[model samples]
Target: METSWEEILEEVSKQIPPKYFTNFIAPLHFVRWEGNQMVVSAPSQIIKSHVEAKYANFLENAAYQIKGDSFRLVLLTDKEESTSHMKDAIENRFQNSEPELNSEYNFETYIVSDCNRLAFTAAKSICEHPGKYNPLYLFGPVGVGKTHLLHAIGNEIKKKDPWKTIRYVDSISFLNEFIFTVRQNNRDSLESFKMRYQSYNVLLFDDIQFLNGGAEKTQEEFFALFNFLYERKRQIVIASDRPSYELPLHDRLKSRFVHGLQADVKEHDLSLRKELLRSYTIQYNIPISEETLEWLAQNCDGDSRALIGIVNDLVLYKKAYQFFLLSDEKIREIANSRLQTNRKRIGFNPDQVIDLVCEKLNVARKDILGKSRKVDFILPRHLCMLLLHEILGLPKAQIGRIFSAQHTTVIHGITKIKEKFSEDKNLFDLYQSIKHQISFQ
Candidate 1:
């Protein structure tokens, strides 16, 4: 008997989670088979690319399993173009396009918590009523879902009104493109570039902080674009590593950024972290016990990206070793190893260094900042000063303000710690241990 397409899909569905299947695979229609190739129809180019990248292998294997014969796979859009034509279609679509919005980063996949609820709500509001905020500015630290929300807004708007045009571009790309156009030194080239940006109904700009240093022309162009879109009441969304007020752009540009709504995303709390872990486990189809999930959530102390990374590592381990059940001990080992390998040593701030020193030395923060001259208080205080200066590269004057001391006092404290480190082996070991903890954190 010949195997039907339904049977092949059934086999493939067994391996993919239901949500993923519904989103990526259920929309696909099996077109007619041509010779030894199975042609499938995807609803859109985005869906076609995702399915081809992630599920093409599983789909091909499923067909082989059901039919007992090898066959090639070909995915086409609803247009049902031939393979040769599909290449041309894709090239044309991307010929002058900005970065495509990721289909996978819609609101449904974003884990909302108190930390990001405001930003999420604001983004949703913009979709429902475009240009209400004019420019919905989202600011947060790295890995805190700012970029995700930016893409989410664009995806939501595009979904609701397919006719609406949207463009997503980062500051660096915007700058590079402007420089390329300027080198042409042609009046028409610059005008064409301006028209391309102004044509979009919605513009999603990311990492606006990158525009801070020495991109005067790009900043001017962006300023003009901002005025053009705002005056026309077109929706614009922006994201950055810091708040708009902190951005070092021209006064006019900074004033424009503050003209609209500004939403901030904070780091995930413990409950939020656990929820994120659970969501990722489900998304990746990893079987993790509640206890293991809790432990991993508590131990991994960064943003959602770090937690998801740990779960992804576990998925790789499971596939590599074929481990049906992962022991808690094994999971911890994997989490620790992955954390060390991917840890960013310079990601800490002065406040974090101070807190770590106080925690390790059992010294009160008040005493560290106070005029305490006791041996115990003095040592911890000096350690904080040294770490802040050496590790963070903070100026001595800035360190003085943090410790409520003069610059000379700050310099003396740091020098004292260095001398202690050279003379005392135990103090050196303690410093190393604290530094290690900071890196892993």
Candidate 2:
């Protein structure tokens, strides 16, 4: 099965240039890999037809370029197909566990950056040692490459050993699976499932922090399974949007994660974002000017996903408008269009005009500008002022004037906002939101 994707991909790669490949195809599912031959499968007949009609020549050319003959293509059942393939046949027969996979998520095309070095490194390490970090806890704030890294790792291991035991489950799904197996008088199946993972070379748990403060029984079960695999040196990988220490995990579990490797995914710098945008443009076959790339990097604050979305939108836009290269003015117009199309004032109410003190400290307009400097009220007020002055693009004096305070107060608030960002995910997310909201459409 896995081989199918490779042969076809190789054929497609040779037929179509890298710049145009992404636009021609979506993420693929490898059915098998064997010898010099590969057997890849597509999700649907429609996808198969699209490729056959539009990209068959590219695939054939790619094959010839690679000094190969014809490759096979298997168009599996589409959305209308039965749920049989969705089941984990091996797992069901051996351990009675279902499958958890996202066919669209894989390693062949993940965008890399320093912000995800730790997650990437850990994921790479797991291909070599699956059970070593049993319950390998990957924790970071949201939208910082946790999911992408996790999925890429899963796909890589699967490609290498199609029959190797693998399970990529979101925390909620795992919990539900556990409950299902337990209630059916198949508790034995649950233990067998753990043992199966223990026997497998790899296991990937995405967004594990979602299990924070879950049912005590579930945590206990997970901990036991974790230790079992850790003892055997099997591979385990996990990802969450919070550091282990910050998670509501047991002290023992926290200690275990700390004992292994812990990596923090940072926010992308301007240069990194710019590079990511270029990578996206290249993938989508959308020619973008350097000035436009800089504008996007400086503007989009939600990381690679946000950047890729813009790229995808551009491809769609070009196809619709019959345009070629993206002009700076057009880019800005697209950005504005997206913002207006999907604007959802995340942290603040759009109806309200936050006063300087109120914005700085997250207090009511009346209180921020009021005489009272109560500790509870003061911090929120100062924080709000900082946000408005710094993140929201308001000048210090203007912010202070709104707060009935001096410019010095607004400056202090700005500093505090930076400090808060270091310790608070909510603050960081909001800061990012404000940046994204103000920039691009």
Candidate 3:
């Protein structure tokens, strides 16, 4: 007797948690078995990729238990189907879309460090108590785990309540949909459009910083949807390049974002980066040495995406070159090729900033870093702290150490400089001059 997909799912459900089976595995369809290969279909490419990476083995095991043999699993998503079939899929997609949560970005796979621990915790809390957090705002620099956490919130919420309607979209997609509906100029389509997002129980919006300028109509629609979700106590998770209050959005929209819990995921420290790299190696079973891992973590400058890429590059290089162990020189070559892109060519650092400030402000290095709070030295000292904190990307504590001042003192100095820049035109000119010299050099 041939085992059906239902039977395989039955075994799979028994093996995994109910929520996991429902959220990540239930929507999958068993297409057919052909030529010793079992075909399964995921709703989207993200889901398919995730299933292939994390759940493929479990699926194989379940299928083997049912059929008494193991077969190769071939997973396909709706987007990857035949062109003719894709037309239908796309048509259905607009009617009622589901969250395109990346399976890999789930709670299990997300690396939790002090850098993102609060965001991670809040995301999990939202999943457990949907709408308890209401509008959870997650903001950070580019390539931080904001998008990952947003998706995790949606995924975990879906798992917690499989019946809940969840939608995850980037700002661009949300704006595109609104523009498409308006272009149609049909009343019914416009109504359908408004109803589309307002119906979701959970909304995850990524890179909301892009929604700052322009897109007036879309912003208005989102404001309405945001209100509807808020009134109904639905969960809303948003990710942006900066804090929600700092975005150039309308004041009304900004108020809504600020009203919610806003968490900032800081840049990954060296220790966090090391753990992230170690997680990647363990996930892929890549045979990288501890020293090499530490070196890569330090050299990668806390960029999670770059760390993952370096690991992938190393794995590929080893497979192609057939090396038992990757030497430091080979790793350096790979890092040079992959990591050098988009980095600063002029090589600006704290030392350079200090030198430029001294030349531009005509202040001796000693006075700038000295304990004396002389009136003349104040501007130069504050200017140096501002540059070190903003341009050099050094922490306030680190900048304080450089100047032999406390971290709070460093913050005060930077804030004072900003206030002075707004009030004093001459000081502002000097500030811009130093910025230009350092930036260009």
Top candidate (lDDT):
1
TM-score of 3: 0.67
**lDDT (0 to 1) per candidate:** 0.84, 0.64, 0.79
TM-score of 1: 0.61
Task: Write one digit per residue (lDDT tens) for candidate 1, span 282-341.
Answer: 887787789988877655656887788889898999889998867878888998887556
Give one digit per residue, the lDDT tens place, for model 3 in 87-166. Answer: 55654666656446788888887888877888888888777778877789888777778888877777787787899888
Clashes of each: 0, 36, 0
lDDT of 1 at 127: 95
Model 2 poorest 10 in a row by lDDT: 349-358
**Number of the top-ranking candidate, with TM-score as the measure:** 3
lDDT of 3: 0.79
Task: Flag regions of model 1 displaced more than 4 Å.
Answer: 1-95, 340-441
Question: Ranking under TM-score, best-scoring first?
Answer: 3, 1, 2
Per-prediction TM-score to the true structure, in the order listed: 0.61, 0.59, 0.67
